[model samples]
Target: MDTETVILGGGISGIAANYFLGKDKAAIIYEQRDSMGGLCDNFSIGAFKFDTGIHLSFTSFKEVREVFDMTPYYTYSPEPMNYYKGLWLKQPIQNNLFPLTPEEKVKAVKDYIYKPVQADDFENYKCWLYSKYGKYITEHFFLPYTEKYWCERAENMETSWIGNRLYLPEIDEVLYGAMSSATPNRYYAQEMRYPKEGGYKAFLKPMLSKVNINLNKRAVKLDSSHKLVEFEDGSKVYYENLISSLPLPALIKIMKDVPSAVKEASENLSATSLILISIGLNVPQDESKSIWFYIYDKDFLPARAYYPGLKSKSNIPSHQSSLQFEIYYSRSKPLSMRKEALAEHLIRVIEKLKLANRKDVLFVDIKNIPYANVIFDKKLYFNRNLVRQYLNNLGIQSIGRFGEWDYLWSDQSFMSGKKAAEKLLNM
Candidate 1:
């Protein structure tokens, strides 16, 4: 098979690229999976349905809204919480310190009021955290939570990815939150939206109609020199222009005769793999009305968890609820226990946390996502740039979160594909 343009991976990025390229361009997308949507995809257990993880659309972009608004969705004010020492504090703990003990609150406020001067340059994420959040806040919350979520210490990670993701509050805001527990939601996203019926992938249904995708076409080898791709089923396709949304490392491995430096850089690129634990309940849950909460206690294996039932009523059966826990692991901090053992551990922890009871648990399911999020460690900039530059020179366009190797939401990923298609069309 041959085509003018070939897009590898039929995720939102690939779909968006082809959509923007127009049907007349005759771009073809090859996806390894039977279905599309990639990370935005969801799985079902009987009547219970859950997304790969927590996926909410809160984009302010007009282009993204125009596409996603095609589907029926429920808009909500984000009310995310954080768990610390058995106290439930609002999200952005720095801005909501009301749940802390009086002594702890005093120390946190004092540290913030007399925090160290901002440095000319931050050595690592740890340095940036201290310079911004002060000692007490960083040590008690941000530092520990960073290690749990990223599976790496803050000191070893880069600060480039922290753009407005973490809230930097005024001293008065912190003081007010410390005085009373009745504080408004301070999450970065003012409001979030989820599909009322279908899963998160439903938002892309409109775009999917405009693109051509071939499923179960896994590319095993690519001869960039000849502009040809060889799949596992012994099929070959020569392309004039290629756009790939494959993980950088996986893409590098399949390419024929890559430079040693580029190969080394690809090997150095690190990302977190997710073990998604989905639990269906026999009874309704109205206790924790919040969307999701971050787990700071090291005793809990999962970094965070969200209530899918809250996201949409159709996600569960009548009067039933469900929870999706996200446990992150990377090459450095590998999974300490097997998936089965980890699921059991998580169940027990959830029971102890009083989120659910063991008897009320209807069923438990596990899903492993290899490329959950890109790890922005100290070596990320140099290594990612090197590999991306090599691919660019080879006339390959890499888009989406994994392709670009950065933290991007759904809207950003969709826009990535559109931007790449535009670049190709202009050329």
Candidate 2:
């Protein structure tokens, strides 16, 4: 097969790139899976449905809004919480210290009031946390949660990816939150949106109509020197331009010949894999109104979890509720137990936490996603740039969260594709 342009990976990024490339341009998307949507896709356990992970859009990008508005969606206020020893603190734990004991609260406030002076440059994420948040808060909450979530020590990670993700409160704000449980939602997004009926994949339905995609076609080899791609199914495609949304390391491996340094750099780029445990309940849940919450306790197993049934009533059958837990692992933190054991542990912990009853569980479904989020460790900056530069020199444009190897939301991934398409048009 031959085309003017070929896009690898059928995720949001590839879809957006094809859409923006213009219908006049000849382009095709080759996806390894039998379906599209990539990470934004959802699964089903009987009538209960669950997204890959918590995928809510809070983007203000005009282009993204214009495209996403094609489908019906539900708008929700960001009501995320944090689970400590037993108390439920607000999403930004630093800003909601009222749940802590009186003595602990005093120590936290005092530490913040007399926190150390800011340094010229932070040694790592750990240093940044200690300097911004006081020693008490950092050691008690941030440090432990960071290790569990990232599967690595905060001292070994970089802070470049922490833009607006963590809230840094003023003295008065922290004091007020400590005095009372009532605090304004300080999450980065004022409102979050999700499809009203179908899972997140519905948002990209319109884009799917505009692009031509070939499912079950996995690209196994690339002859960049001759501008050709070879698929595992013995299909060959010759293209004038290639846009790749595959992981950098996987992309590097398939190329005909790569420099040793570039290959090593690709190998060094780190990412987290996810194990999603979806559960369906026979009855509705009224315990907590939070859409999602973080787990600081190591015994919980999952770093975070969300109520998929709450996102949309249509997600579950009548009088039923659901929960989806995200357990992340990487080369640094290997899974301590098998998938079945992990699922069992999650059920036991939730019951122990009194969030759910083991008897009410209707079914449990687990899915393994190889690429969840890119880890911004110390080696990420230099290594990622090196691999990206090499691909750029070969006239290959990489887009999307995995393609770009960065922490990108759904909207950001869409915009990445738009940018790649624009660049191709200009060229």
Local accuracy of candidate 2 as per-residue lDDT tens digits, 112-139: 9888877748889988988888999999
**Poorest 10 consecutive residues by lDDT, candidate 1:** 282-291
After superposition, the stretches of candidate 2 with alpha carbons farther than 4 Å from their true spots are none
- Listed per model in order, the count of residue pairs whose N, CA or C atoms clash below 3 Å is 0, 0
lDDT of each: 0.90, 0.90
Q: How big is the positional error of residue 216 in model 1, measured in Å on the Cα after superposition? A: 1.4
Instruction: For residue 61, give model 1's deviation from the true position in Å.
Output: 1.4
RMSD of each: 1.1, 1.1
